[model samples]
Target: MKLLAGLTILMIVFVVFGIHTQQQILGLASDMQEMVPNISREINNENWDAARNDTARLLEQWNEIQDRWDLFIVHSEIEQVELYIARILSYLSSEDKAAALAELAALNTQLSHIYRKEMFNVQNIF
Candidate 1:
């Protein structure tokens, strides 16, 4: 009983220390899942190599996450994130990438503003 208690304590400690790291891993996995449809679009457009590369990157992170949680993530929001990544990665040149990234940053800023606004409204009600 004492040994079991000690193991449980250690497990809890490890989990507490690693939750953020695990979440980052999950975030990456979510990005990969989101990118799949964008990748399919690229494939349909006859960009096989680019599509395959994008798919591989996503699959690598996704498979790693699968090793952690059997279910992976069942959220539709993950698909949106992946699509965002794919849209940004579509740029072929470095300059294009920078422009794409800038646009993404702006989009994210807008999303955060909307989210915060909603959150504040919710909080004000209580």
Candidate 2:
């Protein structure tokens, strides 16, 4: 009976401590919420110039992806994605980033299917 009582006390202590720690972490982000609306209003005023700088950084990384597969007759769908990402990287908006990334994922799947068929075709021809 004493062991049970001790265990209950320990659980209560741990729960209290856990709640305290969660509160501390939430407090860190709480201030950001207050700051967000003001920044968003400024951003709407073409104050997102820094975002354009970020767009340039993303473009640098995008450019490193060589279009070596551009002429891959086996996967023209994937090539289309490489070209689309190259063009979409020119935009600074986050929406374009999300859209391009989503499209890229889908095209990769299509390319995988195309690659499997291509391999079979080569084997059968020989």
Off by over 4 Å in 1: 1-11, 59-126
Identify the runs in model 2 with alpha carbons over 4 angstroms from their true place: 50-126
Clashes of each: 3, 0
Worst 10 residues of 1 by lDDT: 111-120
**Model 1 compared with the native: what TM-score?**
0.35
Residue 26 in model 1: shift from native, Å?
A: 2.1
Summarize candidate 1's per-residue lDDT along 82-115 as a digit string, tens digits: 4554565554333254545454454354334333
Give the per-residue lDDT digits (tens) of candidate 2, residues 1-126: 999999999999987865564454334224323333443343345445653444344335434532433333335554564564454344325534445344434434443444443343556357
State which candidate has the highest TM-score. 1
- Which residue pairs clash in candidate 1? 34-82, 34-83, 35-82
